[model samples]
Target: MPLRTWQTTLCSFVIAGALVGAAGSATVTPALAQGPSAPADFTAIARERMPAVIAITARQRVRERETAPALPEDLPFREFFRRYFEERMDPREALGAGFVISPGGHVVTNDHVMGNAEEVQVVFGTSTRGPVRLVGRDPATDLAVLKVDPPPRMMVTAWGDSDAAEPGSWAIAIGSPFGLGGTVRVGVISAQSRDIRSGPYDDYLQTDALINRGNSGGPLFNARGEVIGVDTAIFSPIGGNVGIGFAVPSRVTRSVTDQLIRTGWVERGHIGVSLQELTPANAQALGRPNEMGVLVAAVEPGGPAARAGLRVGDIVTAFSGNPVESGRHLSRAVAAAKPGTEARITVFGDGRTKELA
Candidate 1:
């Protein structure tokens, strides 16, 4: 693959596991980082927090290469080669790392780790190991929750305030890097809220902490021993750690995992209105001279917007008192709202302005 392709394609492929088998959170309170003048004990934080970090393996048996090389021109041994050497792949076990989030065995990891594998397992050091069941996954956020039978005493990691994490703040990552035993690397939060174009919800913490293929689901901790981010991806030309890495911030993980744990799904708020730009033609059809707002292209018969008296041809002027400058703006505003909440919408229709809830 080209280097630019590697840069974009490696986002979800930064995986760790061997050729033997297959592949595939806590919100702690923000432990205030050592102030700008001081440094946190990265070693001490790793020791205290490492116990919560565990290795994860998603089993997929033998699989072939994604694309086989083209056959040689004028090959004489076609039958011999085709029968024996066609797409034979190795047995592999996919391995990554995650952390226990609940004493009852709710674990947090990236959605990519679990992939589509049916068998998933977790191990804490060498003593505690068992299979875990997938509870929920939010691909938009790239977060997932797995449920394992609780050990006698599993150390649950606490979530820290990711919003408080600053660029240049100390960042320590501990996980099963390269599928080796737990490894630790120290760096700083190089940046925050990075949109690597992986998904629509692309908020990520860009860190320089050395995370490799196996570090996808590991924790990135602040100075105070709280998990500020979950290491997820990296930009590498050679598929090894070259410093650039990304982690799902704790704020996104906590919100997603909490919902996953409670409801087994994330609830997205939608007002059920299909919208389009109010173009001159559309406005003329609607018998309006102005094309300043969004036009309701369609409305679900029984959706929230319809129930609130929104209909086709309704011009949505505002949402929750904020001006709806464009269809994209209105869509984002509604999607960001919490489900089950009430908000008034302003629309211009029937030759007058009106508000609906």
Candidate 2:
């Protein structure tokens, strides 16, 4: 029997466990220059924070042998032997990391880390480990939450408003990579609201911190020890952090995390419209010069865009207050908006510029 509606919808990924930081969290570890002085209380921070970070291991049951209806009663003996020889087997194992966010064993980590996991387990600071049950997950944001009954001593990290994290701010990352437990790396916020083309809402915080395969779902802390981002992906031609790593900003994570913990799902608004970036050639034809905007290629019938009189061949220059330079940006903006809320949009159509709601 399937689990109940809420239970069936819960997230299924594993948390942090024994991550081996190969290149670790730095894109390019500077070997030539002496690094800036370490933080004054680096030891204290690690000692105090490590306990909150927990390793997660997940296992999925793989059915090696599947049963098929036996052939007609007259099946040959040779074929019968072959069918009977097949062995039924089950294999289970997966691993990742997550940090304690709430006192009642609420943990946060990457969604992919737990997807397809049949059994999830969490290891606490005192070497005590236990199975964790999934609370909820959001693949669009690549985040998930798990609940465990951990000791009361689990350390917690405070969340900082990501809106205040500007470029060049100090960033520190902590997590297990490649089965290695508890490693730290430091860098600066290289950029913010960077869309890496990973998902519909790809608003990521770009950092120079070296994030390896095992860094997924870890926290990116501001110098004040506040959580600003959740480490997510890396842009490397070689599949390692080559100085270009991305994290889901706290703004996005906080919203998703709250929804997952409370409602077991994200309620995103959808304004159905297919869009494209305005190219130089297309812009010239449209009498636009040096203008950045997204061109509407198609609008779904009855969607918010269509209902609002949005049509093809129209160029969207802005949504709400943020500039829309590409379709991805517009998609994210629209999805983040409330379903019934009226949106302000700037558009160029039929040789006229207009503001429409």
Q: Quick one: best lDDT, which candidate?
A: 1
Q: Per-residue lDDT tens digits of candidate 1, residues 1-357?
A: 432111111001110111121122355787866655555356678777888898888876676744435678688976667755666656566778898888888889888988877677787887657767889999987899999888776688999999898998888898887677579989999898787878756778999999887788889998888999999999999877789999999987887899999999987667777888898897777655577789998997877777667778889887776777787667645655677666667787766677675
In candidate 1, position 194 carries an lDDT of: 82
lDDT of 2 by residue, 1-357 (tens): 653221111111111111111233457755775646657755666666778887777778766765665566666685666566565557766557788888888889999888789777777654856767899999998999988887867788789888777888788888777756688888899988997777889899999988876677788887777889988888889765689988899988888889899889887766677888888998888766556998889988877667667789888887764677788877776767656656667777776666666
TM-score of each: 0.69, 0.78
- Candidate 1 regions with alpha-carbon error over 4 angstroms: 1-37, 62-90, 273-336, 344-357
Quote the positional error of residue 339 for candidate 2 in Å.
1.9
Local error of candidate 2 at residue 139 (angstroms): 0.9
- Model 1, 158: alpha-carbon shift in Å? 0.8
Q: How close is candidate 1 to the true structure, as a TM-score?
A: 0.69
Clashes per model (N, Cα, C within 3 A): 16, 30
